[model samples]
Target: MSTNFDEQQWRAELEGHRDHKDDFFATERQSPIPADQRDAFDGLSYFDPDPAYRVEASIDPIDSDDTITMETTVETEQEYERVARLAFELADEERTLVAYSGVTQGGDSLFVPFRDKTTGQQTYGAGRYMEFEVDGEVTAADTVVLDFNLAYHPFCAYNDAFACPLPPEENWLDVPIEAGEKLPDA
Candidate 1:
């Protein structure tokens, strides 16, 4: 699939959205949680969903010329030996190779927090993310898509009220991912 990321268009959209910080607050004030559901709101201390872009996939197909989804797997705790052996294989100076794994959410969704190489300067200091589907019951046992291009901002980064998940240490990537959303002021 071709990535149609128009830098100028993205920059303009980010800038335009940044200007409406007040509108985000205004809408937040209008949204009320039920008394019984207060805990659900508070319990959502991490990765609160963005009201604007619910869980709906973009109208674009998954593998359209516009966007594409790749598939990979995460090693489960049960596979410690295999993963450990792989890690040892990857303990070299110049380079290393191993079949790594990560959990995914989508069809039984999982939230994998990540900070790409672009953290702090290009993208949000907190981080960005990619979503995927896990096939089984064990949350950690499944396939993942390390699609950097699909990374996106946390709602809080857009407006203060949204609480987003901090990427787990394991999910941090050491490469600069010059894709997805970048700093609005960049």
Candidate 2:
């Protein structure tokens, strides 16, 4: 696929998802925003889509069967099966992020939660999340698109009622990711 066309398509899809979430946050009963706060909610903030934030990453599958327990905002721990590590280049620097599968949510999806230098400044303080679907088992040969422009804040960033897993030190990036969702101003 053409790079320009692919980026355009990806951005359009991201905008659509943002609009849907805005609607839910404004009118849905299960919205993370409190009922009283929803009245003043305009929409979530986001950085303008930039193609530079999209990069191709190679998967490095972990051979061990060990599981990682991540701490949550509620002081609880959640277990995830360590599936693979994604290595890519961002901001002219090489970086790696651990990818996981929910221990109970099955292996159909890969979850990547991370914190960047922008975290607690331009983006959510707790961190953001990205998820991808795995077609069979992910291996070293797998090349996937890692798009920071699609990074999104966890629900806990909006309301305290929702508990979100904190990004481990392994997933913290030293570079600022000026893409995707920004912290909502209250």
Candidate 3:
């Protein structure tokens, strides 16, 4: 849905973002890369950035006060508000993903965790995630950008001590998303 787009600018920005993340993983103290491995960590693996994976989705706001307790990687749970459902098409298939507000996690951005057909093989086994901030509040039928190229593995993918919420069953997709971070080198 990204017609009238600037490919050069998008690629440049994406590269910069990846560079910054690599720097953090290689040097930052709060980075997910283990201290012992940081010295040898070159960078995280990623699928080549593809513009096709970036699509505009219509938001279907959940009117009721619905909440869900997501199972985490560390056998704990995290709560989130069912903010909205994002409707979009990927690989010629109608797909929908739930966008959540991590209220219990004290996060300010909209959280979206998902597992595509590529999961467990090409990317993180548990799944990958995307987060974006809405200017005000989500409104039904509002178009929002869903950039799968920005999907990332949670910190728990690199370290088991950090608990990461798993995507809900509804967010699991039958399509393959070949964009985004891939399984870290074992």
Candidate 4:
């Protein structure tokens, strides 16, 4: 696919997504409630969040094809050293914390996977997240996008037999991420 994404194309894709969402719920009979809240399924729904965002654009190294990692410089005198130490440890373990700018909100920011207050209790046990950076064109490490509304579940959510990225601690958000795919029925 071409790297150039025009505004028109993006708009079309968004419209198509809305159409797909309608079709998906029309045929998929499973409601959006846990067994405990069988009656409340009518109230719960996926796509409850709006997609509007404050865009930020920037670039970071691609850690891995499946998992992209972005490195951020911790700026405070005390925090800088602390984060640097953490980065070293992560490198030692071959675990990278890359700032992914492809997903954006509130400005181009890094999107990291994380477990949150909802993990294992209200939402997916693995948890979900969205992130953002300052808004601008992506070049090197200038900025990136982080849209939390897009925090989603892996294919395993649809079926039980797959391993997926259980969101890590750093990726967790204090707020409810009311976007993307919701947990499949248990």
Candidate 5:
């Protein structure tokens, strides 16, 4: 049985992850903010929590063994196995996004990279990413909860030292997704 996600709990967890020393947002590490400037770093900026951006999507499994090559900011391509397409509604409009898995290794998690109207203005220009793990095969009968509130910027958005895959054109959304991470101060 699937349980509904508690927004408070999820937000708290994100905060914890950011504050933890070994976590991605750790000030001492590869944070987007320069180490000398990190002393003033509080946390990432985010749009207010809105449940409207959270919706359920049906999985449309891909039958072919097609591979998608996504170009990175560093001019290199990363291969991902196109696993499925997630169809859902956002802002009263029907939309779809392709789901992918690592081409080298099979895992329970799926990666979704996307660009929204908010890209380059309020969020990462290259796009943001969301990932979730599923139990067993992802069939049409499986309804996955897609929470835009969980969307995050790629590591490359912070530091150029990191390489991140850019979102494919197929995954770009015309609508503004005002939830999740916002661009860090310049």
Candidate 6:
């Protein structure tokens, strides 16, 4: 119930998730890493878990039946419905990012692809993604946790053979988010 207890629980969960992903990337048959290189694969690079990057934002639903086409790393393109806008504060700055319900998401989860000041520098060049489900009955004014600590690189960042959608400009943030998965070591 204490802030310290909550922080400890969150850090442990995040670290465990990262460890599982490292194992998957290294040893799984369907891993992004080529078979020949799996032996030398250590783990994906990640910024240290920082609680400041975990945030809560209200969902502003997009009431129209509109969609957006996203450019991809390869020839194909992806279409997603702009489901909502999430406004949250990070480092004392108010920021907003669009959330989409794309073909790839199952259930009530929303896909949020974003590029920040860290892109092409500290993290993957194409940007990273976050996904969160709407728990319980949903409403236009619902609040959801946007955990940047769990943001991950697109598959294309690991191998060019897999095409991945680039984040739309509206989701681009001017702030540097110093959390989540970084570009893996070569």
lDDT per residue as tens, model 4, 25-114: 344545222335443334223454443421233344444433333232122111111010012111123222334433222244444555
- Model 2 agreement with the true structure over 39-142: per-residue lDDT tens digits: 99999998988888888888899888869999999999999988888998887788999999888888578899999888998898899999987666686357
Worst 10 residues of 3 by lDDT: 133-142
Off by over 4 Å in 3: 106-108
**Cα RMSD for candidates in order:** 13.6, 2.1, 1.6, 13.0, 3.0, 2.3
Separately for all candidates shown, the number of backbone clashes (residues 3 or more apart, or on different chains) is 7, 0, 0, 33, 0, 0
Q: What is the clash count of model 3?
A: 0
TM-score of 3: 0.95
TM-score of each: 0.41, 0.91, 0.95, 0.43, 0.85, 0.92
| lDDT: the better of candidates 2 and 5 | 2
Relative to the true structure, candidate 2 has a C-alpha RMSD (angstroms) of 2.1
Model 4 regions lying over 4 Å from their true place: 1-12, 18-45, 52-111, 129-139, 184-186
* Candidate 4 C-alpha error for residue 22, in Å: 8.1
Model 3: per-residue Cα lDDT at residue 98: 96
Clashing residue pairs, candidate 3? Answer: none
**Model 1, backbone clash pairs (residues 3+ apart or across chains), number:** 7
Candidate 6 collision pairs: none
lDDT of 3 by residue, 31-129 (tens): 998899999999889999999999999889998879999999989999899989999988887789999987656555899999989999999899999
Model-by-model lDDT, in order?
0.40, 0.86, 0.90, 0.41, 0.82, 0.87
Ranking by TM-score: 3, 6, 2, 5, 4, 1
* RMSD versus native structure for model 6: 2.3
Q: Write the per-residue lDDT of candidate 1 for residues 1-91, one digit (tens) a residue.
A: 1255355664565445443532443345443333344344421112212222211221111121221122212221211110210111111
Model 2, TM vs. native: 0.91
Worst lDDT run of 10 residues, candidate 5, spans 18-27
